[model samples]
Target chain A: MSVDKTTVAKIARLARINVPDERLEPLAAELNGILNWIAELDEVNTDNVEPLASVTGHALPMRDDVVTDGNRLDDVLSNVPEGASGFFVVPKVVE
Target chain B: MSDLLGLNAVAARDALDKKAISAVELATAYLGAAEATAGLNNYVALTADHALAMAAESDKRIASGEAGLLEGLPIGVKDLFCTKGVSSTACSNILKGFVPPYESTVTANLWAAGGVMLGKLNCDEFAMGSGNETSAYGPAINPWQGKDKVDLVPGGSSGGSASAVAARSALLATGTDTGGSIRQPAAFCGVVGLKPTYGRCSRWGIVAFASSLDQAGPFTRTVADNALMMTAMASHDAKDSTSTQTPLQDLIGAVGDGVKGMKIGVPKEYVMDGMDNEVVTLWEQGQAWLRDAGAELIDVSLPHTKYALPAYYIIAPAEASSNLARYDGVRYGMRVDAETLDGMYEATRAAGFGDEVQRRIMIGTYVLSAGYYDAYYLKAQKVRRLIKADFDAAFQTVDALLTPATPSAAFPVGRKIDDPVTNFLNDVFTVPANLAGLPGISVPGGVTSDGLPLGLQVLGRPFDEASLYRVAGVLEQAAGFTMTPARMAGGAA
Candidate 1:
């Protein structure tokens, strides 16, 4: 149940977070500590138990496809770090 | 009138309705109290102008004979809920300077009910930590100073709310409980906190932590006030998919309806090994009080109680990892630019998130990762079912279950900051209720020998918070626990 530097790196990548080389080992140790403790869940017998994804056992209410609320361009862009012409500016994906 | 800040929500509401006090007068008193207690770091932002404006409106309504349910009562809001045009950061650096243009459904409802906003209260960064130490603004100091003026933590991630309510800076404060965030802090700060059943309050506009388990609640000085705030805060909304269609019950009226002949369960498994003696005594006293109030006490078993924390840690982090993914630099909040989009995301997240938040995100990513999904996330979900089943079975015979709200009384700040696992264990008593989507309340039971407060929790059937109020009312009457922090009593000028 112990996590190593490689595993920590992979997790960081998957999470889209950056971990400097120096911090990876300590991070791995801390993750391993938590993961190891969590490993104790293996002791429980959950056979035939359906995974409870949500406590509200009913299906989510569906709504009409028509738009109910939106169209506030200024509000949408209020918190954007970089935006112009009602569009967010990000690193170019298609060079 | 200077003591107006000391009144509970119910009393303040009565005064406001009687014209004995104006909403503006109450709001001004609370604003002054909030400023005076700034040393506790309980409030991250104060909306004094907005509060006064709202109070002025409330005063006009009162003059016109149109006061709302909570008209003019000042309350503190946890930073997690978004207030329109107000800085709502969830106490995380990632959301620094982010002002939400929309208001959370809970806050909107509170405002509509005539509740005045004192300010945004501090909390654990993104509600990730139990001790409030992980807050970017710095931990909220519990107003209750232990021996030699040692500043204790106000138990979090609703730490600021608990501190403010306990300090009488705010008559009531909103809190969200994912895994005991509301109840534990209420216990620590010697206030009453109630986490209603999941979907009881709409979550729209609140920062997502662990979507399924996260629930908005209230912290107040009395069960009656808590119930009053709950009535104002809970409402069905179309915005939150999980919001229930169940009609809101008469929660305030349910209070003081003593729990006579009701079956109250004392779960055997809650008597954990090495539990604090004071917590144990308080729990026993709670049962005795219930029995004295004519409630039939029964011994019940929740076999999966021990598995709740592990499963909660896994599921919450997994969901949080997914929910928090939206915080990439391209959108709202802080941004650390880089040459590429991926680089930008990495740098921004690394810089924005605190260590505890990053750890949770990583844990979540690891558990929900492709290779580990079934082994970790799926298994934890199944464990969640068993935990819920445990409650389902117990509720078949009993109206509610009583247990200690936290393992021990409030400890000094930074005592458990270094150890994540040890800190996580503090939620051991509170997490089961969240996992089961049950309504739970923490009422001040009594104090330890050292004068720190302890709390007794009562978990009720889903959407059955009324029974909890009935039972808690009996306990509150019997215990008559009236201990307030020395700092709070003498600090405010």
Candidate 2:
């Protein structure tokens, strides 16, 4: 199940990371090494076993539905790359 | 008074209580020492004014006799933690100029406990790399040089934290362990590093690495200091749903309980052919030490032990890729404006993330992609369950499991193989604890022939950090690891 240049490139795009054409070959090889190692998980029989998404030993604590926090308009926008008028500025998406 | 630098957090706290050293004096000494050790590249920011002001407040609290547990104790904050108004980059170019507006729950807790901020320390970008090399600011050089005097790597991504604590730049340093980030660096730097149970500490403010595996802990010069710092760090918070409502244990109080009549397991699976000879020796020495401390050593096996690392790779990256999606150019960090929204995300992320981070993101995208989801992501999670089951079976018979912290000691910066899989092998022994959601600690046990420190690890049942620290105390005592790095801050012993 080794990934090739095409697979690497596709995933790179899907991952939103820009990888150049020449770099794709080397990345495929490196990714292959990691994937090949991870393929070892196939040796274990996980049949009928539930996937453990988290290791938290207890149930998620339920809380009453309430807006316990808010109103810090500036704080949310504090780290925006570019912002004005209390809104995040981004490249236009809607045609 | 100059010996204020020599005191560990516990002793320093005692001195402050006795009025032998004022909080201001201690902060001043640590701040000066932090400046002196700038060459180690441990600190990304030195909050001297913050420290002094906090120390001044601590002095007033002392005057009122309302001192907190870590009152006046200086600590180094990992750059991964969001310190309000201070930049928390996680040592990545993507977040190069980003200053978080809110304080992380862990750092906020430390400050609330009267722990003074020394500064934000360096770390692997988003806590991804095994060594500090992946950091954009450059690796934090290990304070300990080999016989040849070549600068070594303080293990990552908590390398800066380990280096600072070992160098005495800070009495204690906060480190987040997603995998072996905390323990590996602690082992390499000859200090105590502990990764508490998964939900033991709040993750509200620390930068997310692998959400499931990430646990906040401490790096300190002594086991007791680790206990003191851990007590201050863990808490239940509404901000982090994963934060535990389980009551916090008396960690510092449990440090000296000793391992008498305790059952410590020695897992044979940890022994491997390619492992360093000195690391093997140290594990054996640790077993002998625990036995000498009245512990009954029993042989145990977590049959799934060998598969832990491979499983970790899938799960960690899968989660990382998802978590890092938040770094799109629009919100924060280094932005490379592109013609379109998707184009902007691609360009900014590509330019912002390092080679290692990009690779992980790519792999994660591959594994979790539509068709490969079950074959990779789900399979890995099942394997994780088996790994936890193995630990459960072992813990049923033994109170805690002991193993080597890292496969080897610190290597010269760049001496380790750069390829991803080979480098991931460095964490062979430490990652299982993270996977199991259990408590694990690294105690500096011995030095390699090259004079680099190696550590022995103790993994305990979930929420049972007390047992883990108890065995660490025994190993720490038996090892008597007093050898200081060639270069240390504060001229500390």
Candidate 3:
């Protein structure tokens, strides 16, 4: 259950977070400590138990495929750090 | 004038109704009190102008005989709930300066009911920490102090709500419980916190952190105030697919209904080893009080209770990882610019999120990673089912289950900040109800030897918050726990 620095780095990258090299070691140790504590779950017998995904017990309520709310482009772009004419401005992803 | 801050929501509402005080006057008192106690760090943003505007509107409504249920009662909103046009960060750097264009359904409901907004109260960053220490603005100090005047942490991630309510800065405050966020802090601060059934309150605009477990409730000094707040906050919404369609029950009426002849279950599993001696003693006293009030106490066993914490840690983090992926630097909040989009995202998240939040995201990503999904995520989900089943079985025999709200009274601020596992364990007693989607409440039960507050928790069947209010009312009446924090009393002096 021990997590090494390499695994921590991998997880951090997967999560889209950057871990400075100096922090990676300490972060790995902390993660390992938590994961080790979580290992106690191995003792429980969960055979045939269905995974409980949603606690509400209701089917996800569906709405008709019609425009219900979101046509206000100004509201959508209001919080954008960088925006243009009805579009978010991100660093160019393609050349 | 300062005494107006001491009034509970029920009393305050009555005064506003009778014209004994104007909405503007009440709002001014609370706003002034909040400003006076700014050292507690209870609020992240004080919406004084908004409060005055809302109060003036409420005054007009009262004049026209159109007063709402909570007309003119000033309250604190947890920073996690989005306030339209007002800064609504989840007390994390990631959401710095993020003013949500849309309001959360719960807050919208409150405003519709004529509740005035005092401010956005501070919380643990993204509701991640048990102590408020993880908040980017710094921890909200518990109004209660320990020996030698050491400042204690108001248990969190709803620490600010609890502290403000306890300190009399706000008559009532909104709190969302994912794990023990509401109940734990309420217990620590000797206030009442109710975590309604999952989906009882819509999660439309509250910043998501473990969606299935997060539920918005209220913090107040009394069960009746909490009940009133709950009545206002709970509503079905089209936006939240998981929102329940059940009509809001008569929660306020249920408050005074004593627990007579009701079957209360004492879960044998909750009396764990190494628990605080005062907490154990207070729990026993609470059981005795319920018995005295004509409730039949039955001993029940929830064998899977011990696994709830570990299972919750896995499931919650996994959900958080997925939900937080929406916060990539492109659209909102702080963005660290770089040569590429991926680099920008990495830099922004690394700089924006705090240590605890980053840790959770890492754990979540690790658990849901391709090779480990079945072992960690799926296995935790199965344990979650077992936990729910245990509650279902217990509820079949008894109307509600009673347990200690938290392991101990408020501890020193820095006692367990560095230890994530220890801090995570603070939610051990409260997480099971969240995992099972049952309604739970924490009511002031007693005080520690040093005069700190402790609480007793009641967990009820799904959508059965009325029964919890009834049992909690009996406990509230019996405990008669009236010790206020030294800081709050002295401040009034």
Candidate 4:
């Protein structure tokens, strides 16, 4: 159950977390401990158990589709670190 | 002046009704106290101007005979809840400078209930830690220091609210409980905290951790005060798809009903190893008192209790990793200046979140990763169902379940910092309720012989807060929880 540097980097990227190369070993160890802890759940005889997605058994009752949302686009964009016009500015992708 | 700092909600409400003190006056007094304790780092941000303005409006409403139960009371809103046009950072750098244009439904509900917001309190980065130490702002001091010690660590994610209430900085405060964030800290800080049924309050606009387990409740110095805040906070919000449609009842009156003839279930499985002796003793004493008070104590078995902690570790992080994925640099949240978008995301998240938050996120990502999902996340979900079945079976015979909030009283700062497993285990007894989405309340049990506070938690069936209140109120009355951290910290000096 060892998390190598490559795997650690990939997981970090997927999680959007930045892990310094120096801290990777310690981070991996901590993650290993957690994974080991989680491995205990495997010993349980859960063959008959159903997956509990939510505490309440009720399904999420969604509303009818509607075109409504917060009308404060300018207000929202005001907090953006980088913005142009009314859209969030980001690095060019296709270009 | 009746020591308004320690007065319960009933007394505070009566004071406002009698015009003995105006909402503005109470808000000012609390604001002053909070400002004085700013060194403790209990609050990430304070809106003194907004508080005073709201208080003034509340006073006007009182003058016009339009007061509600929470009217004129100043409360601390946990920083995790998005405050419209205000900083709702969740005590993390990732969301720095991000002001949500819309208020969290719960926040809007509080304001609608006429409660005045004093400020946003500090919390663990995205509500991820057991001790407030994980907060990016810095850990909040317990404010209960004696001659021999430095200030203590207020327990986590809700630590700021607990510290603020304990320090008398606010009359009441809101807290979100995913695991034991509210109850564990309330016990450590000697305050009352309630984590109502999972969907009891709307999670809309709240910075999500584990959506299935996350719930917003209240923290206050008294059980009645906790009820006041909880009632105001719990509502059927159509916006939150999972919000319960259960009619909010007057839990204050239910508390007066007492626990006579109630079947109080003490589950055998929750008596975990490594629990402190004093907590065990206090739990026994609490049970004895409940039994003497005409309540029947039943020994129930929740066989899958051991699986809860591990299941939660898998499930909470799994959900957290997903919920937090939305906080990429392209959004309004903090973004690091980098050469590329991927680099920007990495830099921003690395610079933004605290260590513990990062650990959880990484763990969450790993568990939910492609190959491991079946072995970890999916299996944990199945175990989660078993854990719920354990409670469901226990509740069939008993009206409510009771357990100690934490294994021990408030530990010194840095006690469990190095050992993340021990810190995670601190929520062993409390996490089951969250996993099962059951409502739970933590009341002051008794102080240890060493003088630290002890807490007992009562878990109830879904949407059955009335039973939880009845049982908790009985224990609260028997416990006679009069010692606030301020009393220990020395009053107003």
Chain B TM-score of candidate number 1: 0.99
- Give per-residue CA lDDT, model 4, range B1-493, as digits (tens): 6455655667878889889988888888888888878877888889999999999999998999999878989899999999987899888888878788789988888898889999999888899988888787888888665445666778887999998988888788999999999999999888889999988899999999999899999998888788777888888888888988878877878877888898988888777778899888888888998898888999998888998999999899889888988888786788888877888888888887778878888988888888988888889999988888888898889899888999987767766456588889889989999999998999988887766788998999888888888888888888887765543222644
* DockQ winner: 3
* Cα error of candidate 4 at position B287, Å: 0.7
**Cα deviation of B385, candidate 4, in Å:** 0.4
Q: Model-by-model lDDT, in order?
A: 0.92, 0.91, 0.92, 0.85
> Regarding lDDT, does 2 or 3 come out ahead?
3
TM-score of each: 0.99, 0.98, 0.98, 0.97
Ranking by DockQ: 3, 1, 2, 4
- Write the residue-wise lDDT of candidate 1 on B1-493 in tens digits: 5578678888888888889999999998889888888999999999999999999999999989998888999989999999999999999999999999899999999999999998999999999877788899999988987677789999999999999999888888999999999999999999999999999999999999999999999999999999999999999999999999999888998998999889999999997766798899899999999999999999999999999999998999999999999999886999999989999999999999999999999999999888799889999999999999999999999999999999999989878455588889889999999999999999999999888999999999999999999988998999998778876833542
Off by over 4 Å in 4: B486-493
Q: Candidate 4: DockQ?
A: 0.77
* Pairs with backbone N, CA or C atoms under 3 Å apart (clashes), candidate 4: none
Q: Write the per-residue lDDT of candidate 2 for residues B1-493, one digit (tens) a residue.
A: 7687789888999999998999999999988888999999999999999999999999999889999989999999999999999988999999998988899999999999999998999999999987888899998989998889999999999999999998888889999998899999999999999999998999998889899999999999999999999999989898899988888888888888899999999999997667999888888989999999999999998899889999999999999999999999887888998899899999999999998899888888888999999999999999999999999998899999999999988988878474678789888998888898998999999999998999999999889999998888888888888999988975533
Off by over 4 Å in 3: B416-418, B489-493
Which stretches of model 1 miss by more than 4 angstroms? B489-493
